[model samples]
Target chain A: MQRTTMDLWVGLFVVMGVIALMILSLKVGNLNVYNPSQSYVISGNFENIGGLKVRAPVKSAGVVVGRVTDIQFSTQTYDAVVTMSMDSRFLFPKDTFASILTSGLLGEQYIGLAAGGDEAMLKDGDKIMKTNSAMVLEELIGRFLFNKASEDDSL
Target chain B: MLLPRRLVSGIQHIGHRVIEGVWRLGVASRFFILVLLKSGTSLRRFNLVIRELYFTGVLSLIIIVVSGLFVGMVLGLQGYETLQKYGSESAVGTLVALSLVRELGPVVAALLFASRAGSAITAEIGLMKATEQLAAMGMMAVDPIARVVAPRFWSGVISMPFLAAIFSVMGVFGGYLVTVVFIGVDEGSYWSQMQSAVDFRFDIMNGFIKSCYFGVAVTAIAVFEGYDAPPTAEGVSGATTRTVVTSSLVILGLDFILTAFMFRGVS
Candidate 1:
């Protein structure tokens, strides 16, 4: 009787722990966001990635269809090489345009994909040809100031 | 001449303490290895580990759950107050879940485990030593390390990750209750924003790994202190206190190093 009770309680404790882990992985952590088994890899090259990071969302029409898997800096071309794991459920054409974009005024940056009218769909390991780099706020302001100075000189 | 002699003595005392500390650390490492080797017996006799699990893991659930809930509630209140200033109150879920999963969950759970279960293990083993029960076992041809120490150590190792997981889950639930149920934050945004932000591999797995490290550190310290106790009432009390203090410091230090390595460029 004593042994069974101990076993029963210990079993219950272990079960609860497992349930908690499941909740963490499913509801809280969103495990389905990037299941490698159900996804395909694609890469994009950009001149300036700014603050874009690995695991950043890749959205199409404001809905996340993929995630940034890896980000590497190409020393030869000075381009940010971004690798994304796109969900197989969502397919984009070969001429899709990929751009780094921010959500709000100062929120996390994500990759936005605008599909092009192409008959062929992109596959795994395909490199996105059309890409736009992140818009750096400081660089834009600097350019605006330089334009103003140039206009004053002209005047 | 007298002042010089006193200074020399001070230097000698400092050297002595450093050597003692180094020697004690070596002994602890040896003890940990011995416990690992003898852990086979604990597994063969599974109920031993289960019994200790009940004592340490199951018993500590109430304190862990209540504290987790309260901590989450406090975080919700504070996070909403700060986030609302930026007119981004909807991101409260993201803030609560991210912080809980990444930093607070494993760290706070380990701290609580150190105080509640770590101290208990030390006191139990220390008391056993005080009562000469360990010596009694040795006379009966039983290895005290295998019989008493290994079971407790393995139990701690097994239980810690679970305890930390439960703590994180409760904390997230508590935050949800506060932010969505009470404060009237949009439930859709609360969950969706959090789902987008919290990644399973990076945030959740890292937190789990952190808790596992804490488990090993806390239990190792607890068992070592208890085994090294002076076999007296004061010694047991002091060992219990040291178990908590040393475990807390180690947990925090290890957390810092692990966070630096794990979250270096991913943020």
Candidate 2:
């Protein structure tokens, strides 16, 4: 009887460990098991993706509403096409703006969504018309330097 | 002239000891293979393994959880201070979670397990040998290695992954307590940032796999030392010390190899 009781406790302990691992995988590792199959997919095209990778968070109004599911380069358009899976709970307008954004000045990049004032909501497989590519600091700095040089030359 | 002679003898002694150490490693590996083979018949010996697991694993829970909490808090506090300077204080959660999950989780837990359970295993087995209990079992036509040593060895292997998971999870909570509750950082960023940064396959799975390997190496060393020790009080105590010291070193060494294999492939 005592042995059986001890076995029960050990079993319970193992169960708790398994549950904690599950939480770690889902909450910490972003496995996204709760994202239902009914979620919608939307594509946005960008000239540059920066450091964005698959499984990046898609946030709307500072709340995570979905995830970046896939990223592919369109050969014909010569642009990076990003596919996002948005949860069914949230709906955005057909003209929603998709922007590549970073958490901080130098942190992981994610997709940020801003809803537009359109009456028609986005449906499955819809394309977001307005897209913002990742802002490259190097390109901005280079442009600033070039503008300063050109102005000095004109003077 | 005298100094040269002494130096020559010292070099010779060192060379001899290195060869002996290599031979001892070979012997230990052979013993491990034999024990693994014996464990094939260990189904009937599972009750014994469970009892040891209760002692070695369940009893070590307090120390593992407490240490995990403190480690996480320290990481959180340090991470917050460092990231605050760069205006990325919200990344504290990611910093703490990544550090704990990637490196410290398996390594620290295994170190503690070596000291707590690994030493206990060696001492227990050594004492049994010293008291001639193993010899008595042998006289009764029972295989002591199969019934006794194999169960303890396998139990340690089975328990390590669970211990490491608990350590990481508790550590995560400890970090949350500090960053979100105590420091007043935005709670959502703490969790969401960590979720997006740490990957399930590469970071978390590799950490657990490292623990399992450490588990096998540490327990094999512990049980082998116990069974190899001389049948005396001094021998039992010495074996216990060797188990703790040697297994700790092996765990650290294996961590480097495992980390290289687990991470170097990712570009």
lDDT of each: 0.92, 0.87
Q: Residue B65 in candidate 2 has what lDDT?
A: 92
Worst 10 residues of 1 chain A by lDDT: A1-10
User: Residue B167 lDDT in model 1?
Assistant: 91
The C-alpha stretches of model 2 lying farther than 4 A from their native spots are A1-3, A33-101, A110-134, A152-155, B1-4, B265-267
Q: CA shift at A48, candidate 2, in angstroms?
A: 6.4
Residue B102 in model 2: lDDT = 82
Best by DockQ: 1
* Cα DockQ of the candidate 1 complex: 0.78
> Candidate 1, clashing residue pairs?
none
Query: Per-residue lDDT tens digits of candidate 2, residues B1-267?
Result: 356888999999999999999998898989999998898667575787787788778888899999999999889999999999999998888888888888899999999999999999899889999999999999999998898899899889988888888899889999999989999999998997788678777788989899899899889999999998889999999989999999999999999999898877342
Question: What are the DockQ scores of the candidates, in order?
Answer: 0.78, 0.42
